[model samples]
Target: MADTPQNQAALALQMYLDTSASPLGSALQRAPMMNIGIDEGELATLPLVSEALTGSQRLRATHAQDLALTVDVEPDPARHALVWQMQMAQTGEQPGPRVHNFRPLHIALDGSLAPDLVIHTWRGGAQQSFFPPDAITPERHVLYPRTTAFYQDGTFTIGTHGGRSSDQYMPYMLITTADDSGGLWVALGWSGNWQARFVKPRGTSDLHLTIQIEPCDLRLPSGTTLQGPAMALGLYEGDAAVGYNALRSWLRSHMPALPSSDLSHFNTWTAMDANVDETRLLDAVEQVAGNGLHYFMLDAGWYPSPPNDFYSGVGNWRVDETKFPRGLEVVAERVRQRGMEMGLWFEPERAYHTTELATQHPEWLLRVPGREHALVNFALPDVRAYFRTFIADLVQRLGLRWLKWDFNIDPLPYWQQANDGGLAHLGHINGLWETFDWLRSTFPELTIENCASGGNRLDWALFSRAHVNFANDQYTNPDCIRRILGRMGTFLPTERLNMIYGPFQRREYDDAAWQVLEGSSFGVSEPIDNWTGQFRTSLRHHLALHRATDAYRSGHFYQLTPDTDDLCAWEGWQLHDPETGSGVLALWRSASPEEQVSLHVREIDETRSYRITDLYHQSGSQTVRGQQLIHGLTVGLARDAATLWTYHLVDGEENQ
Candidate 1:
């Protein structure tokens, strides 16, 4: 009998953990999953003892003297994935030496598996495709859908340049054999600067992989613990999609269930931009209330700002009396009356030099040498407490159901400059988590949307805390949105990627806009009151279609189109719900001269017949055998247009 994927994955994990079974022999039996450099020597070289924790899937490795490592492993056989968290600490009577190169996931794979290995990595951010003429610098070119690949015997190191984890490179990696016979997906669960190094020896298949919180050279006091970043490993057999789907499934199941994940939002940022007044906001709320939008988000600029100086007024969390003399309560109340929830934006991490938070509590601010605006140091207990109280008070006073947390500044310089022995980033991240935890515990129904100048903080660590992520600040470009959804959906769960559209005057691409929006959890930045009758009707139709297909959105996502920036090509993706035998397929014909293209459905039962309906065009349904759908389904779309379809298995009686 052929070995199941689960069996193969379990075997791979066991081999990975078995220190005694290495071909390098018993001398290397004390191999550690994590690596740390201390004054004495490398932590992995020390004689260590390992024991399992009682009644848990956790294991502890300890040295006779000062160091110890704890690994908590969660194996999900259903998804064929192994997720684990690792932490290293100083457990001795004296302070440990400044630690160097602290890596949570440091492993060496045997050489026998090297020849066919291929590494897939992605740049994380919105401006990935804006090269040379479009963007001033080459740095702007580092993001999806421009994926980077490394072959066997290649040595490459990828990492974030600043505090935002995914600002440069995504905190995920895929290593698969060229034949697609076997593969592994690894993800780092850190929201700060992280590095992953891959080295394949020239003559052997021995692969060395390590993930670390960079610029780390911190001392561990006797009682102090240095928690390394968390790591997750997934194993799969067959094509690369199997591994991607397995990781996505595990993440969706393990992460917190966000209330806003399924709700459609209407943000006022684009339309009002900071020039908002009480009458305007309330008017906007009224328009959004019954338009299939569940949340009326009064975005940035709601806070007090000096005339023509909104960017410098972030630290002030109070509503501007000039704009909202009645306060936000009136708008919130109106939203509730109209059957929609209220959401407000806040950038608590930043404070201009003149702001009250920065002027009065300068000690609580993280400042670099020349930067005027400083980060509200979450590492300080007082800072976290103050923000928690401030946000909670607003949440209660305005009856807010959602909060958009924005961090506009890059904090790496401030963190790296801290006097603390390279542990400033770790402390600040911990504080951030603690603050979010407190907020969640206080208001069980509140939803938090994570945004860091767009997609800067896109990583598993942040996703574990926040409900949904605003992909990037590029909310106006339909072409950009299409490419983002296609590329990001490779690793991220489509339902959690918040796609914001419009306020752009491109009326011709309205269908294309709605098509891309339907591919993920979406929001509208343009007011419905200003939309044309046709556009408004299209909005309502797509909104209803979005809610109707919410179930399939959370299932396995398959990108049917290639990840490219070619304007003359068809692009598409599919969301398949295996449990319900239903799914959604979205296609985009972007400037492509070709009017017809054939799409082959994936992961469907060939023996069954499916009822497929074109939801966007309101085209009637047709029944076709799943085999035929899998073989190829002809879809005709005009240039600069798109289509959405939902398919379900036909009932036995109907099939007969």
Candidate 2:
């Protein structure tokens, strides 16, 4: 009813590309124009998951008989959900990964003309199957030009001669089948976080149809989540059941709406510290405006003509009458009269040659055309419409909500002045995704917090709109923030406890309160530039335990094995609440020189009864419980130390 079969694969792709020698619309005129010899520059989109298209012919074996598997399973009564699938044969092709003998397509909810796809059909080395075998008979294993979409209704297209724009690190695709009994053979490979590999059909050649898309925010009728830019399915081969059923119906119709959780505030740049002065920056902005801080940032030599050549700072954004001669509206009106909120720091698409808009226009950046020294190409669309009209005229003349947007270079030799024989990188990564949709539709309330030369484009399409990320240069290097927050919290959420570095350390740093009490206490980097008083009482005791945890900056956990938890580093959080300590137990210090670390604390639920303290060493009450203080806990460290323990359940003994 919702216009089925992707409206007949978008009305059979306007009747098979209307008529351009429809052999898959001449697969872009018998492919090959990715020009191998190389001449012009800038040419992006590259993925077939590497090894140069895994021995070509789309990973060999395209049927002579035998090996046909398709699956589907259903049961989702208004959210009791269950829709599995594995389909791949039936000539809508794409053979590998879809081994025969299927059955699992179960359907219900009445009006059933069938819809339950959860396939997983394997063959040889001990066969397997279970697709459309039950639920009042359903045998759907359909997939062909049957509606293919990477992003629809708005627009999306990718197929640039086998993808892998930068390092082919298992950008996903591993379906195998070879000891032949005939048809079906998909080796084209790559996957990791666990690990996988394939791509071995023979010699390898170009086969890109890659459409690595990601857009699912769906926060309605319950929930769903997926994010941006980690894409790369760019290539088709060995019968891919109509491109994996048109990429699972373009990710079940490109979901959106569900992105909110940053809990901002992570200061820096009140004159990129040359060792803070001006009476230690007016005493660290009156103790970061009485700790209600959201942002007081000013960073990078308060402009006025400093960008000697970052593509030469476009029409220079003012305020450098020689380092703030009472400008930047008097330090943004004394940071809005210290109620807190000022953030600054800009890049306006690089223009440094000691700036003056790069000693005068320099023909608005992005070079390689004639080459007067290159690199500075936001894939040029008039240099991203002159940085979206100079950041919509500097956030409407510096009222500035918040923008620390930094890119720090890396995108070379891409001239693009309406390119042609210029060697395109898919329109320069679609002009870097249209300079991030011109900075979120032109400053959609500025909160762009991103930096490149630090975390190297920290994947998932720049967290779908820079949802506050800096996390690299590891704020003081907490061993690279405990392995990138334990592998990006298995699909981000717990409000992405956004990270940034710097904290009470001096001299290059390694222990700023043991790297901000070991990674992510959301937005806290200390360099109190010289405001001693034990650096304002350790940023007021880490902003009083970051204003009493909002579930350690947005809840969700389970990592009780960091080389066996030292000094209490356990995990737990997923409460709806009704009793028993609602969650949180960071307790810092996993040892460095402070007594060569050794304190393993494992899953402490050991039959309830908890009460730990040390909210920076207690002030009231004999809070001890947890079987009388975790077996008489005697954990302490002082050479650049850090502590945090706030447990409460004063009485507990019920899990019956």
Candidate 3:
């Protein structure tokens, strides 16, 4: 048998020996077992730990320690990309001096590998500059929010942003040749502030790609070891879609399987906001369960009141006795009685000075000395232990099956001042991972949704631990939802996407909205308790579609059309399950007054016939040859309308 790509890329640590490190007084500097290359033609060397500099000024990193690394190569036959990952840590016995930027992995590619290779990189994220709820809804809001911008270039340029808090950075890149034949998809697995720069020098065909953590500011106690984020690079063949599917597969292989049963949820934040109480919540849960929602969440306001907003009472984590005279358990029991699981919303990492945790243990908060709001300090072991116990008790006591965890503040400045500021920052991040490990291990039945003010903390590291993410907080606009759904699945699986549904101006836009929901972890914010007859019927219809097509969420996602800035242009994506020869396509025609366009769907085998059913168009199912479906499908829209088309091979050939 031929040597597989997995075997071809795997190498022993001896191959990555840093012989030159002997001068540094250590030969075991090769502690990190590293590997490189997708094939024999291109190989990667172990990372060279060195001082970081900016404009000739060397970073003031004093505490020097040993670097620990682990590299792995896992190749999937169905995926076009060959996956490679690098994980590193710093082992130290004393406090470090100043904050420093350390590069943990580097890939040096020779020009001879692929002549005229075209390097393509996207900003990965667009900063969320959302409009207030009262603002007039234009035919569209920013289809691509300021926080989620994408860019591509060939030269070495710096595109950096603060992660999670101010900007939602997506550390992803696609590198392919000029012909789009061969390339790699790079995914930065870090959730906190990190940066990536694509450097292509003037003279050589050599490409240098570096992945590094934001800072090394921790003052490590004796014998302490701090680990950094992991990085995955997948090699693929063919076009952008090919690379996208490959990256999806690589992530799927690494992601832990969450609940496979019904996960459709209804959260109250968008609908009720801060005006919520037990009576309202119990009513909402009853209605949500009746309308086919599987999970009911009482978001934000259940805590003690500042009356102004939910932000002030964070960290209190208490159900106001006045609001819920019987306590939160009453609502949880109501939801359970209605046949729905219960979920609670929490901003566990941020707190107001007045809250219990902040007032009782001032030392537990990390913040700029004069800041009013406290950044829940994860650097404290006591704090992490408290959260572990708190969460475990809450879930077990309330019989809660889901938790919506959110982070709404930036703690970079506070972390920079921590015990060993640089290393302190790393410790805070590591603390979150440790907390998650405890939760996952202790409460295997609970599902956690990662929401850093909506999709900011999205990456493989968090995704491997959390079940889903909020794509955006501004869920009212159809255009924005359609655009996000089109691109997000390229980086994350659709099933793991918590697609928020809201009230748009036209009921017609609901189909496009539900298509996005059907393709992911669908959630709605509506007056569920008092739903109308028409609304109840509509909810049931889409809920059924979600159940039937949910399996395809683990399949490959392909962007059939390029994302657009034009108000009238259409954007669409396909989620394909090759094993089943079935898929779902979500196509949207934004206010582009143009009524219709010809869409060419891909991935269907030509010899087969498929039955394409228009779920929203209610146009019914039509059997068409795969050749015709892939060639051209004339789809028309009325103004800002959308369509959800589910297609599967008609004959037994699908399984054959």
Residue-level lDDT tens digits of model 2 in 139-160: 1121111233223221212111
List model 1 lDDT by residue over 136-211, tens digit each. 1112111111222334345678888677888877888877655666567787888788888887655554556778
* Residue-level lDDT tens digits of model 3 in 163-228: 452143366666565556656667766667666555444554445566656555333454555556
- Best-fitting candidate, scored by TM-score: 1
Off by over 4 Å in 1: 1-31, 45-55, 60-69, 88-96, 128-153, 221-226, 507-509, 527-529, 617-619, 651-656
* Superposed Cα deviation of residue 23, candidate 2 (Å): 37
What overall lDDT, based on C-alpha atoms, would model 1 receive against the true structure? 0.72
lDDT of 1 at 381: 77
Q: lDDT scores for all predictions?
A: 0.72, 0.37, 0.63
Which candidate order results from sorting by lDDT in descending order? 1, 3, 2
Model 1: per-residue Cα lDDT at residue 413: 87
